[model samples]
Target: MKAARSDRGSQTRKLLLFTAERLFAEYGVEGVSNRQVSEAAGQSNNFAVGYHVGSKEDLVVAIVRRHAESIERRSAEMVARLPAVPALRDWVSCLVRPAVEHLASLGVPSWYARFIAQAMTHPTYRKLVFDEAFASRSFRHCHEGMFRLVPQLPEEVRRERDDMGRLMLVHMCAERERALQEGTASPRSTWESTATGLVDALVGLWLAPVTGPR
Candidate 1:
């Protein structure tokens, strides 16, 4: 009886997380309440989200963690295959492909990219998501490898470009996902191609000459 109950509880938690991701993607995180998430998941108790996931912040983290785990595993594999002295494009591919691959694996109607785009637009949630991403060891390894190829960059320029690269990746994926869902034209036919374009652009962004602030 205890085992059966535990299984049911686990099922409920997964349902809530899945429902919340779709809800947040359609309606902004701040726009969706925990009660709505629980109710949307078909739970009689509107507090199911609270019981299983804690607060709104906790719910968001749970969703992020679920996807991050898959992305992290892919990243680890790519990192292991790095060349003895990896080029900038190689490191950039490591950073970009895992995410593109993960999104591709989800097939059509995948809400993660849009959901992430929304979370990143929120003030508090943006930091929470970024902090969670930065915590991935494989991601940090890629970051270090890419940085090593550009050690000549001033710290400020590097930081600026890093932010630009990250925003570009996130928004680009979100747009592609939206296009796929809406049956609109996408820049590339496949996620692999999308990653290629991002890697190419990021390589240029990093190698661009830094101009002093006016």
Candidate 2:
């Protein structure tokens, strides 16, 4: 009986997480309340979000955590395959492919990319999401490896391009996901091609001449 109850509870939490991701993706994170998430998940108790996942912040983290493991695993595998002296595009592929591959593995109608785009842009949740994302060892490895190949720039320029690169990756994936779900046209025919395009663009973005003031 206890085992059965635990399984049901686990299933309920998964359902709430899925429902919340879709709602939060469509509606801004701040626009959706915990009660609404619970209600949307078909929970009789509106407090199911709290009981199963704690607060809104906790819910967002839970959503991120759900996908983090797969992304991290893919990242680690890619990192392991890097050559002795990985080039700019090689390291860039480490950074771009894992997330794209994970998104691809999710099949159609996946809300994770959009949900992440929303979380990254949210005022309250931005830092929390970034911290969770960058906390992975594989991410740090890819980041450091990529930057080593990139030319040195002023601190401000480096920071600016970092933000630009992040926005590009997150929003592009989100847009592609949205397009796929809506049956609209995407620039790339496959997620693999999308990752290649992002890797190419990011390499150019990081290596672009710093024509501005020193």
Candidate 3:
């Protein structure tokens, strides 16, 4: 009886997480309340979000955690395959491919990419989400490796481009996911192609000439 109850509880948490992710993707996180998440998740108890996932912040973190493992594992594998003296694009691929591939593996109508886009754009949740999403060791390794190939720039320029690159990756994937779900046309025919485009663009962004002062 205890085992059965535990299984049911686990199932309920997964359902809640999925429902919350979809809702949060469609509506900004601040727009959706915990009660609404619970009710939308079909929980009789309006406090299910709190009971199973704690506060709103905790729920958002939980959502990120749910997919972090697969992304981290893929990143680690890609990092392992990197040749000595890997090119800038190779390191960039380590950052881009794992995410796009994970979204691909989730099949269509997946909300994760959009959900992450929303979280990263949210004023309050942006840092919380970003830190959780990129906290993996593999991600740090990829980040360090990519920057090593980049030409030295002023600290401000580096920071600005970092933001630009992050926003590009997050929003492009979100838009592609949205387009796919709505049956609209995407620029790339496949996720792999999208990764290629992103890797190309990011390489250019990081390597572009710094025309401004310093």
Better structure of 1 and 2 per TM-score: 2
**lDDT agreement with native, every candidate:** 0.92, 0.92, 0.92
Name the TM-score of candidate 2.
0.98
The C-alpha stretches of model 2 lying farther than 4 A from their native spots are: none
Give the Å shift of residue 176 in candidate 3: 0.5
- Could you estimate the TM-score for every candidate? 0.95, 0.98, 0.97
lDDT of 2: 0.92
lDDT of 1 by residue, 1-214 (tens): 9999999999999999999999999898999999999999999999999998899999999999999999999999999998888999999999999999999999998899889989999899998999787569999989998998875887778888988998899889999998999999998999999999999999999988877778
In model 1, the clashing pairs are none
